[model samples]
Target: MNVGIGLPIGDPAALLSWARRAEAGPFSTLGLLDRLVYDNPEPLVALAVLAGATSRIRVQTEVLLAPLRDTALLAKQAATLDRMTGGRLVLGLGVGGRDDDHQVAGVPLTTRGRRLDGQMEVMRRLWSGQAHGDGAGPIGPLPARPGGPEILFGGFRPAAIERVARWGDGFLAAAPPTWAGGLFDTARAFWREYGRDGEPRLVAQVNVALGPDHVVDEARAAMHAYYAFTGRADHMVAGLLTTPGGVREAVTAFAGLGADEVMLYCYGTDPDQVDRLADAL
Candidate 1:
């Protein structure tokens, strides 16, 4: 199993520092969380900086909310990042759930799933250089590659699983064990039914903070902040808080469940937090 670290997108200096450290850490990849019109910096721009800063670690957007932006523009940005990163970009995408997030983006929250699906289709066409003009002629300049970055779909719903099987290169499972089990099973089944070879690549994100003290209070505080930001407190409680053993156990569990990669977010921007996790992992 490959391990990756999530860089805090809210702090530019800290993000850069963490990227530098991650290039030398045990992690094989560096991930950035996406939040438009929130405290977080733009994932694509942050990734651009990371592309220039690191040479080896793969850069990923743990997820960028697809329904919140223009599909063609996003494809261009992702392609540019992939080119800049020397084809080391993994684009994880989702249809956002938070109403306030959509409000911030000035888009309606309803039908986000449908919009996301459409956006994905359009992006694939644009990336593959098959997108056509209004009269069905070839469109403008294409992405650096004939196909764009590897795209992964994130969520634990049945529809999400189906979407991943139909259109994505892999799955990004985010729910706790109960929800994740069903989603994984569904994804595998869909892959088999679609005649795809092997299993789809799975990437799981878990909140982690490592220290000798097993800081439950700190973990809970971080969970609260995550909930406050994402507004999905109820869905994440069990999987979000962790002791040292819990962190190890979570990693073991995800590995056992066939995750190809795991990205751990250490809940805060403190360098000490990153150091603790680096030591623990």
Candidate 2:
């Protein structure tokens, strides 16, 4: 499987440096996570900036919260970004589980799934040059790719996995390989059930921390802080791959399960970790 690197949670000043390093390394994509109520930079804008700074590597939202945004505006923004980036954008979206995020965005938490379902159709139509209403013109500029940038859906629920066949180009498994294999299978099954012509792209993400004890500890702390809202930070922390061998093993396991790409989610802030990870892998 191709390996991608996530933008680490660290000094904002170092983010560009980190992205540049990741591009120069063996990584295939630069992935970012999204949270409306979090202190981290917004994934789309940050990724656009990063994409401008890098030449070859793909830029993606590992999973952006789709139900929190205005659908039409999001379609326009994503399309513009895709056009500007020369089709390097991979938009991975999910109906986020965090209530606070929905609350902050003024979106109803209970309606997120329905909202995402409707929004997907609307966005697709807009991207395809359909007007919003009788007098309104179509949104522009069109995406670099004809049907919009390649979209991947991320979520644990069956309905969410089914969306890959109905609306998405692939599945983004945010869980570890062991837990995510079943989800990936469900997505593929749905794809076949819908009579899709080819296989749905399967991508897996794993939390990773590498380097000296202090840097690794920093990564552990960052993960705990981010996932603290789930009340399962310890469980998430327990799954982190800290050693070089562990990273290699996780990549191999995900690849064995037919993941097209494995996103190594680095939580440490150090930009040099990119080089270290490249050497390790």
Candidate 3:
């Protein structure tokens, strides 16, 4: 299985440093998490900059909250990025779980799932050179491909997996490998149910930190703070892979589950961790 690295939470200099180092490393993709209510960098814009700075590794949003953005604008931006980056963007989309995010974006929380479904439909049409209105011309800056960039759906719900068959090219699993086999199975079943051409790509994510004891501790603290909104930070932190052996084992386990890629979410902002993870792999 291929291994990808996630952008750490940090300032501009630190982020660019990590991205540059990550590009030179043996990583397959560079991923970023999304949040509008928080102080995190906007995933699309940040990724565009990182992609501009590097020519090799693909850039992805681990899971962007699609319901929070205007559908047409997002389609334009995604298509532009896809063209600019030579079709290296993997749009992992989700109906967000945060009430504050929806509230702040003026989108009702209860309608997010349905909104995502409609948004995907509209975005696909827009990306395919379809006009938005009766007299309106098609959105400019078409994507690098016939459709838009590759799309992956994220969530643990049945509807989310169904989206893989309906609109997405793959499933971005947030669960650990041990608990993810059934989810992947459901995704495949839906893919066949929909008469999709081939297997739906399966990608798994894990929180990882490697270095001295202090770095691991800092990584755990960062995860706890980031995911505290879920009320399961301790449980999540307890599952973190802190050693090279642990990372290797997780990769093997995910590969055994037929994952196409494994995204290692590094919670710390040290650029050196790029080499550390590459060496470990």
Give the per-residue lDDT digits (tens) of candidate 1, residues 137-175: 434345455577888888867787788778888998866
What are the models' TM-scores?
0.88, 0.98, 0.98
Worst 10 residues of 1 by lDDT: 137-146
Top model number, lDDT: 2
Deviation in Å, model 3, residue 279 alpha carbon: 0.7
lDDT of 2 by residue, 149-256 (tens): 999999998999999999999999989878989998999999999999999999999998889999899999999999998899999999999989999999999989
Runs of candidate 3 exceeding 4 Å displacement: none
Q: Candidates ranked by lDDT, best first?
A: 2, 3, 1
Candidate 1 backbone overlaps, count: 0
Error of 1 at 130 (Å): 2.2
Greater lDDT among 1 and 2 belongs to 2
Residues 72-108 of candidate 3: C-alpha lDDT, one tens digit per residue? 9999999999999989999999998898999999999
Assess candidate 2 and give its TM-score to the true structure: 0.98
Q: What is the lDDT for 221 in model 3? A: 87
